[model samples]
Target: MHFQWYPGHMTKAKRMMQENIKLIDLVIELVDARIPVSSRNPDIDELGKNKARLILLNKSDLAEEKQNDAWAEYFKEKGFSVVKVNSKRGGGIKSIQGVIQEACKEKIERDRKRGILNRPVRAMVVGIPNVGKSTFINALAGKACAKTGNKPGVTKGKQWIRLNKNVELLDTPGILWPKFEDQTVGLRLAFIGSIKDEILNTEELAMEMITFLTEKYPGVLEEKYSIEISEDSYECLRRIAESRHCLVKGNELDTNKAAILLIDDFRSGKLGRITLEFPEDYE
Candidate 1:
């Protein structure tokens, strides 16, 4: 299946990020834990160069634990201060303050040397859509933190959410677009709902998802759908149609409907916490 991306919106998002990056001291990047590499748009590295980087593996609860550890180590090796977090449930949220301080330690040290003291670390959350950036900001800042409105010298209408005495976050997150030049990366993004559904056939995508699950997860489909696992993805899809009673008319199995159901289940974490690609799988 093929996926189409709008270059126009991407260009706009890049421009916005470039403008916003200049106003912050640290970039708190969020990546979908299930597809860490695929969900990320590497353009942020170029746009946020020289900024203190902290990568939050958001939705870590929906990913395999061992893979989460590997991804943390993977980004850490690339020089990002990485943290695993389940923003929805607040797991791993407490560690963020400490991690953020550590991630910006260099900046804080420089501030001290230059005789600048007690200046809060300014941060901005950035991520591709649906990677849980909004949820993360809310989780980090809570509801009680008031918006520090535009100041005299700062840009008008840019709100700063004071997370604490030592840290303040930009109220708006810097949006980034996922790179789609690589077909494999596009496919991975499509698999995770980062790409639009209209661009790809649901049945083909579900079959591909089943193929991957059968190979990597082993028996997830069988256990979830109560159907025999088959090496042929189409056959497995047919079994899902039969088990779920997905029918078009008069007992005719509706494989398309079943495919949509399977994909929906996978996306919503119903099929379980499944990570499509591992950090080791990255080039």
Candidate 2:
């Protein structure tokens, strides 16, 4: 399926990141644990070059544990200090301060050598849309510091929240790169609700989700819907509609309704923890 999702504000957000990166000591990037590679914007590497980097595998609660460990290891190997976190529930939030110190040890030491002492490390939180960046900031700050929403583009502008005497965080709006050259990347982003659902065909997106699950995660549909699995992904959606009584006109099965239900269930973690990309793919 063809995929496209780029809002005008994201362009402005990218420009903002470029202008502000010079003011920060570290870039704390949040990536969806389930789609670590897919959720990442390639431009961050260029935009944040020379800045200390930390990667938070956010929404760990919704992704497979083994994959989360592997992705963290993968980012760590790439020289990023990595943390697996469930931002919505405060998991892994407490350790962030210590990790930030560790990630920026060189900078902190440099300041000390120059006798510029006691200055906090300035960090900026950034990620593709709807990847829990705001929730992570709130959890780390131990308060409702950033506006929270499941929809993409909720946090409109930058806001700085001082965490303590040693660390301050600049929260920025979520931004997607200008385009997604790879359709798979776009699809994976869509799966995690990083892209707005209303812009795409829900039925098509759900069919792709069914296809991926049936191949990568066998029996997921069968167990979730209590229906026999089939070779065709469309048939699986039909079965889900039949089993769950998604009907129209008193008799006709509403596959579109079933599609939305299945997608919602996956997003809510009812279908089970799933990780779309594997580290081995990159290796």
Candidate 3:
């Protein structure tokens, strides 16, 4: 689910979003719970303006509970209905229906005043690739009696999954591109495996992760790899290499192999529930 963004892809995605956004009354945004801010596309705010907004903190199972609460509050402060969810195991998903109604309350009230009645809230799921968009959709729309739709000669249009009497979701999730202009954003996305590894130096990336963990999530390296934290990130990496037996021929520690191992561990949640950025830290 790694994404490589190009200008052409960006343009096409934007076009599709514009087209689809018109068909929905609510925008359900999914962001990785660990790197909530960095995993977002700023363009969504502009495109989704005037729509009922709900931010679902996806992958909550892999993020610190305190951080997840803080993130929900952060989005709530910005006027979005927020829900912390772990799409992988269906955690917090049952509450989604209630939250969606709350988010679109104003819209429903307005419709009522205009004599509109019983209209279901139309919503769509959107996020950067590999942020578990598909998993969230499947989890929300599990095996049930569902309906399909088709427009004559219109490329077999979208099917709305009726979640209940008051909500219908778009079948396809919108894919948004990450902010590539910022080096830090790119690095964070890379660390989460949202971007291609070929474009990055694994050793350098691992060092950056080591530096972040030691400073912000203090003791993570020590607890997981049994390595003493050092002022030098490279030294910590070497310790991990030794503990993990990431050695080259002749039994010498292979720093490159160790870098890959460290990155994999962090991405796979082996390091622990971690949030790369925090609201206070950004402030």
Per-prediction tally of clashes: 0, 0, 0
- By lDDT, the better pick of 1 and 2 is 1
Ranking the candidates on lDDT from highest down gives: 1, 2, 3
Task: State TM-scores per candidate.
Answer: 0.95, 0.91, 0.92
Off by over 4 Å in 3: 1-7, 151-156
Give candidate 2 misplaced runs (Cα > 4 Å): 144-159
Q: Candidate 3 residues 115-177, lDDT tens each?
A: 999789989888988899988888888876275465343245567788777988887744778
| Candidate 2's TM-score | 0.91
Worst 10 residues of 1 by lDDT: 171-180
Model 3: which residue pairs collide?
none
State model 3's lDDT: 0.85
Global lDDT for candidate 2? 0.85
lDDT of 3 at 259: 96
Error of 3 at 68 (Å): 1.3
